[model samples]
Target: MLIRQLEYLVALGREQHFGRAAAVCYVSQPALSAAIRKLENELDVTIVLRGRRFEGFTDEGRRVVGWAHRILAERDALLADLDRMRNGLRATVRIGAIPTAVPATPLMSSLFSTRYPLARVRIESLSSREISRRLAEFELDAGVTYLDNDTPPGTRSVELYRERYRLLVPADDELARESVVEWAAAAALPHCALMSTMRNRRVLDANMAAAGATLVPVVETDTVGALYAHIATRRLASIVAHTWLHAFGVPEGMCVRPLAEVRPRPAVGLIVSDREPTSIVVDALVDALSGADLSEALERSLPPVIPG
Candidate 1:
């Protein structure tokens, strides 16, 4: 029997009405009925209960419906497996990363390419929350996000590096001369910027509050790029994770300093679903990220910024 007929049977079982099932399947009721009849004839079994209206499947049909689901799932897996072998390492490895982790993408990409030599990687900017959701849905093969705090359930994690917060300000700013800025002192500065959705911001906020001050960011943005851009224009001073500077070139006449008060720096890492299988390309990317020395790689890939 045709797979379409099997699909029609499964839809009929779910919808429990010919009209509704046909509507879901985007076909006329008669067409669905005819397909089911053909299927029954080929199998030489009474698959459906006949009545004035559509009814539930027969016992034989019910068993067959279960088999159909399994069969279809296997069919899809087969196709994916065949495609992978045929294409070698050329398949797209869809990845999601937090704003702070954006800078680390190219180094990871370069290392992955050196290993696979043929794989193509697509990296998307995503928040930690969205990254977990996409991974659960199997839309993303892997994601780069906070390793400990924001990670969701049932995912394999790979620790990459610890991201320490640092201050980015104009070179001529009053606070620039200090070896390090206290969280309390930085909050009192004019025009401080924050990334509203990031866990990094939450950490900064908590640190500032602990230091007997609360942040009142003159600029709040979703992306670190925007925060950096504003700092470049001399509009704001921002507390940024060290990883971001690895990705983007800093503006002229800017300075950076480690935030001494915010101790026990947070860790950043990769997360992949435990339920979903990692494609070859994804494995290569993971190997590259886990195997390389991120601090040294960042130094080589990125222009020198004021060291934190």
Candidate 2:
């Protein structure tokens, strides 16, 4: 049977109505019905349980529908593979990243663009757990996330950088005068923090607990820029990724100090599936990371801005 017939079958199973399924398939009702009938004839089985209207699939038809899903998915993947091979990594490469790692996306995109200037690079800000789920389902080409978290099976993670927390404070703030701030001391200040839903927020929370500090943030937000805003006004302080200061300078009037004596830093890195015959785009993206030290690279690229 043709793939169209299989599509018709899948649509029928999903919609559970002949006219509706035909509409979804963008074909006449009779044409869809004829295709599936031909499918049933070739297989020598009654595929659908029919009445005046579409009933449901029989046991055998259900099995065929399951196979159809896998076959269609594979078919699309094969076409994508062939296109990439012919186009030389020109297809859109979708990369998901945790919010804290977003600053690194522009660097990766710039690297990928050098070899394939025409290629489209899409970067999405997502949670670590959400990135893992999307990676497992093949919805995302790669992910930039904490490599130490529970990784999905069949996915490989390559550490790109060790992410450390930094305390951001106003320039005139007494704490900002210090070159290094202890975790307990930083956590004790009246500060704005990332919302509890963020993975980095959890990491900071654990670090505070381990440092025997009580963290009662005066304001909580989901975005780093908001925290920076509060701290910029000199009304509050914040803890944020050290790397973030590279792409984005510490807000005007604010300074950053490295957090000290905290728990071990987590490694944030690139994650892709280990499934054989990886997509060329994925391969190229990984290759772009070769010999790149995220921390050092960022430091060299953006010299210490004087909080401008």
Candidate 3:
């Protein structure tokens, strides 16, 4: 089917309303509806359920919508490739990064923009699973997420930096007397750990279990802000990624110390699909990431894994 037809069909699937989808495509409602009908006839499938209002797509229509997404994505990539060939290296770069990695994004973006002044960057915060999915779907040009895990086929990863976990406790706690609180020691204290939903929390739970301590958190939250706010009130202690400590400044009377003997420092890396040819914008980002000293940056701004 024609690319424009696929576009109209995809918009209908997303909008779920003929008038609304037509508005999105900047076409008259009847014109958009006629294009979708043409597409359905060409494919020999009933793509949409007809009614006074747009009801929904049939199972066949849903499958077609999935294909339509990939087709549109590939079309955009092709156009982007052609533009890059005609003009210099300048285009929008879509990126997905894990929550803990957000702090480094601005630094990396600034470095890239300074080097390549003409390009634009769009960043979205997402979980590791979502990042991988988006990368495979060609929705994201690249992603920053935990490495060493099994990556999707036809994608390659490059190590950007190592992310270490730390114990964040109020300064007045008994463990705060020490410069570095061992994992065994910190685990014994009442923890204000992240809820079980976050990967960081899972990593912490595994490490704490090995240290002969079970996390008995007084409070649990998904966001760093919630954890920090609880810690600031002296109501909870938390295990957090060292980078998070950098983004959300450590509270007063808080200590950050590395947890010893945690498996896989959880290297955060940039992942790009091998199937889609890398654009100049992506290449520049890769180059900047490879050369940058992210560890040093983390140390300068981020608090020590434990209170100093």
Candidate 4:
């Protein structure tokens, strides 16, 4: 039926309640419900669950919602194509990135903003698995994350930089005087580590295992701020990506040294959906980043950590 009905259906699926869905669609609940009824009548199938309160969708309704997502996404892409043909590219590009890439998002946002001044951009920090899942669901335009043998299908990747490891040790620590440290030495220290819940941590685990080393962190945190806080103690150290140092200066009393023994470094890159008919906005953003000054974005020199 009407595209508006499909829009309502998709919104309903997203918000999972009639009132909130109507609010998102900028319509009253009654009107939105009537539109859904009409859509079901036209399609000759029951698409919405009939209930006094918000209930889960029926199996068929779920399938319709999936189709609705694809339809609305393609429709928006078509509109973006037309708008770019007549005018310049002007549409919101929502990007999702892993926590490790959060510091790098502004580079992409600024580039997009400069190229298409009128276009809107949003970058959200997410887990790598979440990024890949959202990309497949058409919820994200692109993502920045580690790419390895396990990279998900239906993605077009552009390598940005290799993620190198650095050991952040207190200035007075035994290993602080060294310009470089072996993984075995770093693994033995009482350190703060990113929680294993993250794919980044998993990658680190695999790399350390390969080096015959293991991390037995004194503190584990999900956020960088927390991890940094734990590292404030001269008794603790952390092995982190050098890329992260560009965002947060090294903690107080900490000195960074490259890891001399992690044989291969994992690459971090930008990944977009490989849909057959790619979105115009995705293409434009990729083109903008094609000649990106990655060196600046990849800056990893450790700053002198002042005592806090």
Among these predictions, the greatest lDDT belongs to: 4
Q: State the displacement of the C-alpha of residue 301, model 2, in Å, after optimal TM-score superposition.
A: 4.4
lDDT of 2 by residue, 1-308 (tens): 79999899988987899999999999999999999999999999899999999989899988888777656656656776687678655578889988888888887888789867767899999887888766655567899988774666678777788876677777787887676788888876888988988878888889888889877899998887777677777568788777777767677767777778454678888999787666667777888876677777876754352332
Give the range of the ten consecutive residues with the poorest summed lDDT in model 3: 299-308
Instruction: List TM-scores for all candidates, in order.
Output: 0.71, 0.75, 0.83, 0.88
Tens digits of per-residue lDDT for model 4, 1-308: 88899899988887889999999999999999999989888877888777788787778888887888888889999998899888888899988988877876777788878988878998888888888877876778999988887688889898877777778887777787776788888898888899999877887888778779898888888887678777875447888877678777677667777778554667788899888788889998898888686655566344643332
- Give the per-residue lDDT digits (tens) of candidate 1, residues 1-308: 78788778878876889999999999999999999999888888888998898667789987777677555544544565577688756656789988778887777778777877776788999888889866654557799888775579888888777776667777788788788788888887765565656677887877887899988888787777778778888657777766776666556777776667556767778887765344454565677777567766654644444533
Q: What is the per-residue lDDT of model 3 for residues 139-197, given as tens digits with 9 covering 90 to 100?
A: 78899877765555677777767877766767677766676567778877877776787
Winner on lDDT between 1 and 4 is 4
Clashing pairs in 1: none
Best candidate, TM-score: 4
Ranking by lDDT: 4, 2, 3, 1
For each candidate in the order shown, give its overall lDDT on alpha carbons.
Answer: 0.74, 0.79, 0.76, 0.81
Question: Least accurate stretch of 10 residues (summed lDDT) in model 4?
Answer: 299-308
Clashes by residue pair, model 4: none
Ordered by TM-score, highest first, the candidates read: 4, 3, 2, 1
Higher-lDDT candidate of 2 and 4? 4
Model 1's number of clashes is: 0
Ten residues in sequence with the least summed lDDT for candidate 2: 299-308
RMSD each, Å: 7.5, 5.3, 3.1, 3.0
